[model samples]
Target: MSFPQLLTLLVIALHITGIVVATHAVMHTRTPQGAFAWALGLALLPYVTLLPYLYLGRSHFSGYITLHRSHRQRLSQASEGSELAGLPPSCTRYGALARMLQGTFHPGQQLRLLIDGEATFEAIFDAIAQAERCVLMQFFIFHDDELGRRMQKALLERAAAGVQVLVLFDGIGSHALPRHYVERLRQGGVAIHPFATQRHHNRFQLNFRNHRKIVVVDGWLGFLGGLNVGDEYLGLKPPLAPWRDTHLQMSGPAVMDLQRSFAVDWHWVTGELPPMLPPRPAQGDAYTLIAATGPADPQESCSLYFTVAINAACKRLWLTTPYFVPDQAVMSALRLAVMRGVDVRVLIPSRADHHAVFLASTLHAHDAIEAGIRIYRYQPGFVHQKVILVDDDTASVGSMNLDNRSFRLNFEIGALNVDRAFAADVERMLLDDFGKAVEITGDEYRRARYPRRLAMNVARLFDPIL
Candidate 1:
């Protein structure tokens, strides 16, 4: 056969393979829009779409799910005869949300709300300095910038002081994290690994990302929330300067659960559980539940967490997130909450970090405004906090955003605090944020340029994978 004929045959074979993948996507994609989009692109433009499909198409992390279920079973059997679960009785009210996450609302968690990058990094560094036994740190992004170097130095100091320090960062999120940044820590006796979904069966898949940011020191102190390790997180990056974010520091029995989450991810990456300190007694009186969810979950745990929290709101629900691409169920829940007379408000960034996400969020915000849910855009710098305030006695703070990535694809964590004082604190913080934000009026969408409006709707088409 002629060489050109053979080349044409190879091209046809690739197109056929793309079609087969598209068929699989049609069967497995969780949303109709995603299915149609993938199928169309794959069938018509195999050369362009096939490679992206390999990275972005898969919706399920079956490999991690199997490992998680097996490990949970073993852990359950091991703890069968241990003391009764320490979760408070009121936690049962969280219902299936709590069970699906396999966690309980343990009383006696002392939580300190860290308002911005400065406060968060200070608290984290102080805790690491005080670590007596071990320090476990994980972040979705770990830059080698000034702030990142500060964190590295602190961890190195602790490691040198006879503390066992281990760090885990997302392989994809921290892809640009230089090798020397990691080697510096390892050279100083700190053990570090990158969480990658590149195992044998999941080799071609890169959709799942470990987006949880957690820091545990001696199993007594824990930090989790929106701030990643970078100069940008410190408000040092121009244009996005004065970065607004939120993080929580917990000192109590609940830290054990946070540690467990880190251990699970660590085990997944290293095939061995890092040594954990025994549970310490309760250090505070606030009830806290660490809701860790990811693609491995049996259900859409993060989405349900938001829905449950929204449903639990009797009088108010105020949320702040950098991304506002809520899935159908969550959008429905917000609308229903408004219909039920709940004061629902959503705060999103006014500036664009990801132009596509910002555009998509504008449409979602307009939809929310039409449904009686007040939408506000932070006018100062970017608002990157993931916070939820429900009524008067419940609040959640962590890394889960109001987007599909957080809903199903990313490994996320949320600390749900059921306490009146914490709720009041959250309310005050949100009030200040709302003050800095401008309300999106009903006509805001109508006033947009036609081209920009068209772009937003086009961006919305990518919501499933956004």
Candidate 2:
């Protein structure tokens, strides 16, 4: 065929491919706005949009639902008739969330709030040092920096002591992580792998990330929250230094749930279950539940988890997250909380680790302020903790951010504690944080230069995938 004829045939094929992908987006995209945007771009500019759509258009993780369900059922059956304590009456506020997640809140969980990277890692390392049987660890980002080397040393020591150690990190988040870092761990007898989603037919699906940060030691101690293994998290890096974050340490039956979460991810990656131990006896009086949500879920469990927590608030609802790009349901829940006369406050970082997300968050903060919700920017440094305080009875600390990615795209996990004492600890910590933060108003957005405002508005258009 002539060059002109060949070009014509290729152009026609490209348009047809775009239409086919557009149809998939319309049928599979989680939100109407996302579907419409993808469809419009694919129809009008196939060359420009087709590659991106291939990478990011799908809302669900193919073949993960079946794995998740099978593991969930097996875990449920294994725990049946066990001596797992039931939730206390005061902890029932999160019963709806438990039901939605198909999880149960266990009583007698001892909780410790680990603030900042230093304390969190110290506790985690101490626990690993004491692990007699096995250690399961996962993080969204695992760097090969100072803190990462410390983590590597700790895990290597434990592995040398004949303890089974398994580690998982996100492929994309730790793309820059040195191969030698992982090689050293493997050579030291640690089982390590990246939590990759680009297996088999889903090679183009690079959007879904396993963002949960969890550590389980000997099936008795557990940890989860916002801090990842990096020098920046330790506030050792400049500019965004003095990093702020929160992590939870639990000792009780609840640790088994956290371990189960790690196991599911491990199974997904390695096609084999990691070593797990039976649930331990009650260690304290706190009721705790693990809410693990991701794209494979049939419902938006993470978004619903936030909404339920917000709706359950009668007196106050305070949240802290590095990112503040909430979905419509969460935003509506916040508005309703304000209308109900509840004190709704959100704490976000003033620093911009991600410019686009920060702009979008600024716009969302303004919208929230207009609805009587208070927004605060932490002034000391980046506040990367994901925490929720509902009244005086409930609090949660975890890796789930208050954003679309955490709500619908990423595999996130949080530990909800229904105990006044734990809530009080979170309250006091947040009170100190709030003291350092400045309350923002709609004027912050309204008074911005026209170009900045326009950028924010443009950024908001990408909220779904942000």
Q: Which residue pairs show backbone clashes in model 2?
A: none
Tens digits of per-residue lDDT, candidate 1, 89-147, equal: 44556756766666667778888999999999999998888999999999999999899
Off by over 4 Å in 2: 1-16, 74-86, 201-203
TM-score of each: 0.94, 0.94
What's the TM for model 1? 0.94
User: Candidate 2: deviation at residue 235, Å?
Assistant: 0.9
| Overall lDDT per candidate, in order of appearance | 0.88, 0.89
Q: What is candidate 2's lDDT per residue for 1-466, written digit by digit as tens?
A: 9999999998899899998899999998999999998998888889899998877887766566888987767766765544234545566766677766778888888999999998999999899989999999999999888889999999999999999999999988898999999999999999999987655635577688899999988888889999999999999887888899999999998888888889888988888999889768896978888899988887899999899999999999999999999888999999999999999999999999999999999999999999999999999888899999999989989999998999888999998888999999999999999999999888899899999999999999889889
Task: Give model 2's clash tally.
Answer: 0
lDDT of 1: 0.88
Going through the candidates in the order shown, the clash numbers are 1, 0
- Highest TM-score against the true fold, candidate: 2
**Candidate 1: where is the Cα deviation over 4 Å?**
1-14, 74-90, 200-204
